[model samples]
Target: MSFIARTSLALSAPNRIVETAGRSLAYRRFGTGPDLVLCVRLRGTMDSWDPLFLDVLARHFTVTVFDYSGLGLSTGTASYGKREMARDVDDLVSALGLTRVIIGGWSLGGFAAQTFAALHPHKVSHVLAIGTMPPGPMLKPPEPLFLETATKLSNTVADEYILFFEPDSAASRALGDASMARIAARTEPRDHPTPPEVFLRSLQASIEPSGPFPDPDDAYARFYRNTDIPVLALSGDHDIMFPVENWYALNDLWPTLFVVTLPDSGHGPQHQYPEMSAEIIASFVRHTAAR
Candidate 1:
């Protein structure tokens, strides 16, 4: 099957690093316009993102993706906690001298993005969360299937389909295959995968009854409630991990928050609908900035 040819730019972007707080942080930058920094998800490195999605975003913004400290090729202490990971984002932003940026993430990275925007609101121009939940109790806890597939030492394309695509939709599965092919097409040097022990630690932390944000006064919740900065929670209608309904439930409480739901999709809407996802994000940044 033939795939779109636009993924080449993201596939060919070179790996680079910056010194931050005495540690070297691994990253890649491509595209143009304002800075947009994306944090990777649990068990993910910069290499895990779909090239088609990244390339499309590159057309609108100077996209940056990176590895958390001590994970992948970066050197430093690593912790899966959202607050700790937010520090990584902060250090990277400061190290790059980016005065302002659009902060985005997927899954666990979404948790980090939320925390970073809350902790350092001045640095983030907007918040874009893909296939992730907001802080506090979720409308639906993660399904067992996600854990069964996600914790594998290495995932096959089938496992990826289960973890990211809608199992009940044939079209979504076909798109998932195409996205996997686009990711595999990259021949450039890539970041190392997160170790099993590290990812297991994250899984354990997430499954605890308290969840990612145990505090009653979660920073993300408070930030969403009051901040003037626009927050876009992008998700699939049937996500098994972080359900999109959770975001919809809080739409009235957050002042500058919006939700975008894609039907017949699951956890990775950006991968299944790369061009549409990028356009939604670019439009969000553009229209919201005008307000």
Candidate 2:
């Protein structure tokens, strides 16, 4: 829990605490106007999110960002899976009495956000899926690498994973192998790696009976269909995680489904271009709400 709440001089934002999802989830609410839920990537907490980015979002809507259970400060048995996490989002909204929210997510978090909306369409007024894809072999080349890393890192602490998201600072990049060596020293949790059962449960929830979803070739059209709500997908051209090709394929399926790419951005642009990104999604929500 210290990772989510224990603040250092680096943290610039205040927090609003709440007990939801059966945990004392530390949520941060900003933007005094409409409601928006920021579904963070896997194993994230509100604090790990960049405050500068969130502050920008707060300017337009009352954004709700919380820790997913079993990560950071959120407490519970460390059982992991998308269904449970998606359910947590449902529980969070219901507990807060919010009937409508523009649910958005990043990476694995984005996948779950879309799934939550698809499963509970009535609750999600709008959807924004950033840096995600339908599950399958069609995903980016780096996905398999990421899976390998995830399987190896379940017992690791969040700090060790920071380099995956952080930009290559000149000072650090200049150091080359030495830089990664320093980053690698960040420790994994000593308790234990997540058990195979937890991983299996997560996999079952993420993929359908046949395989992973959106089927890349038809993701955009598919995601936009069966619901009248607006949808957007933001990605990066260099995203090795689920490379730009995946999103390009989605766009081909639904040419009208708006999409954007951030220059030099990898998987997390909300942190890199918070205000502009927030504006993009908030505008769509407002437009849809007016309609």
Best model number under lDDT: 1
Residues forming the 10-long window of minimal summed lDDT in candidate 1? 1-10
Indicate the worst ten consecutive residues by lDDT in candidate 2: 183-192
Model 2 segments more than 4 A misplaced: 1-24, 135-139, 143-223, 289-291
Note the residue pairs that clash in candidate 2: 1-73, 31-58, 134-213, 135-213, 156-188
Per residue, candidate 2 scores C-alpha lDDT tens digits across 1-291 of: 233224321133344456764575555565677788877765445544555455556767777877666555556644335566788788788878899888888777776687788778788777787776643445445646455554553434332232233334332223323323332332332112234565545554555443345344444336554456667787755555666576666554443356777765556655555567767776766666412
Judged by TM-score, which candidate is best?
1
Which lDDT tens digits does candidate 1 get at residues 1-291? 234433367777888899878888999999999899999888899888998888889989999999998889898877778887899999999998899999999998998999999999889899999999898876678899997888888888788888999977889989998888887776658778788988787567645467776657576687678889998999998889898988988889987888999999999999999999999999999999513
How much is 192 displaced in model 2, in angstroms? 17
Model 2 residue 18 CA deviation (Å) reads 4.4
**C-alpha displacement of 249 in model 2, angstroms?**
1.4
